[model samples]
Target: MATFHHYPFCPQSRFIRLVLGEMGIAPATVEEKPWERSQSLLMINPAGHLPIFVEEQGLAVPGAAVIAEYLDETRGLGLDGRRLLPDHPADRVEVRRLMEWFLVKFFEEVSAYLVTEKIYKRFMKAELGGGPPDMAAIRAGRSNVRYHLQYIGFLIGKRNWLAGPDLTYADLAAAAHLSCVDYLGDVPWEEDETAKAWYARVKSRPSFRALLTDRVPGMAPAAHYEDLDF
Candidate 1:
């Protein structure tokens, strides 16, 4: 079996996890703290990041994007579910665009702020930059999430999925980030019913079960977190 080094509440890491789950791959996971920057983790990925996917044969894939692509290329097809990458060139481009938008734009503007300020700061050791949470950063991230949810609604209205007719990596990436924020109960789903409905659909997928059931030690998920109807 492959080994995955990642942390709970990490958006990028969640993306890779969902991809692996969707592909029916069960990997042994090692939770790592990027802030601690362990020497062993650095040896595998100089970037000192979470989510280093290592194969039993010693093939190591660092970074969520690389791991996702690797899984897609190697075990993307002939599985129980639909392929995460689209077959058509244009559709693939759209999926890539949406994937980058969520992984980068959404994270930079919103998810990262909340994850860092709320989760990391609360649990991480003070020497490693963890302490009291930053309310201002959390506020900014909460405000920014509305726009991103609207965008998801817009995309879902046009296509059956985020990228096209099939549920691609774009949907998984978006859900991964949203799932992190949602755990903190930051998303204003009630403000946008369409987006809430769309999320409800994605949340019911078999691949999302693990994410919904995930718990972060002292912290608890929202009342509606594991509620498929919510």
Candidate 2:
């Protein structure tokens, strides 16, 4: 069996976890605090990032995008029609585009601020920059999330999923970020019914159940975080 090193609240980590679940790959998971910069973690990934994937052969794959692609190529290809990535060249491009949108753009604009301030900071040491949550950044995350939700609604209006007719990494990526924000009680779900509805569908997936159960040590998820209907 492979090993997965990750943090519960990290969106990128969550994305990989969802991908693994969807692909039916069960790896032993090790919770890691990137801020701690443990020597053991550094030995595997010098960058000391969370969500590293270690194969049974001791090969360490770091970074969320890289791990997602690696798993898709190694495991997903055998899943036939159930693969998260599309088969057509154009469709694959769109899937990658939306994956980037959520993993990078959405994370930078929304999740990074909220999770870092509200969740991660609490667990970090003062010397490592942990302290009271930054209200300004939190406000920015709260405001920015509304726009992203609107974008999701717009996309869902046109296609069954974020990238197209089938569920793909795009949907997983978006859901992973939103799940983090939702946990912080920062998402304005009422402001975008379409997005909320789309999210409900994603939330109900078996692959998503584990994420809903994630609980930060000192923080509780939003009341509706685990409600599939919400």
Candidate 3:
């Protein structure tokens, strides 16, 4: 069986996992702490990243975006469900556009800061200069998240899914990041009915059930993190 190395709170890892789930491919999972800089991780991914996908024959695919596309090409096409990527060239562009928006823009502006401060710092060794969560960064992430939430509402309002008619990797990417932030109790869902409704729909998917069960060591998920009705 293929093997997947990842950490629970990492959005990139979560994105890859969701994509794998959509592909109906279950790789043997191995939890990894990249902050620890394990020799095994460095060997698998010279970039020293989390969410490395190693095939049965020992082909290691690193990074979430790369792994997502790799799976779509190798497994997604033959899967017994909706295709993760659109067939048309224009639609593919839109899917990649939104995927980049959530993975890069939203991540840089919000999720990255929050995860680095809130989750990574807590488990990170003191020798690595890890410390208490930075209140300033956390506040900034919280403020930035609202704008992204509005953007999500804007996108979903015009389409059935974030990208287009069918659910694409774009939806998975957005949900992956938002779900991590939501796990931290940082999402203000009550403020945006449209985005919240869209998220509720995503949350109800069978593929998302495993993510809802994720539990960080010392931190419990937000009250509504796993609640389908929320």
TM-score of every prediction relative to native: 0.96, 0.96, 0.97
Residue-level error in angstroms, candidate 1, position 89: 1.1
Candidate 1 on 27-95: residue-level lDDT in tens?
999988766788999999998877899999989999987887788788886255667887788988998
lDDT of 2 by residue, 1-230 (tens): 99999998999999999898888888999999877989999999998877899999999999889998899888874233577987789998999998999988999999999999998889889999999999999999999999999999999999999999888999999999999999989999999999999999989988899999989887778998899887
In candidate 2, what residue range of length 10 has the lowest lDDT sum?
A: 74-83
Q: List the residue pairs that clash in candidate 3.
A: none
Cα-based lDDT for every prediction: 0.87, 0.90, 0.89
**lDDT (Cα, 0-100) at 32 in candidate 1:** 89
Residue-level lDDT tens digits of model 3 in 1-230: 99999998899899888888777788999999868889989999989987899999999999988887888788865255777887789999999999999889999999998989999999888889588988999999999999999999998889999999888999999999999999999999888899999899878987888999999887888888889998
Total backbone clashes of candidate 1, pairs 3 or more residues apart or in separate chains: 0
Worst 10 residues of 3 by lDDT: 74-83
Model 3 ranges with Cα > 4 A deviation: 78-80
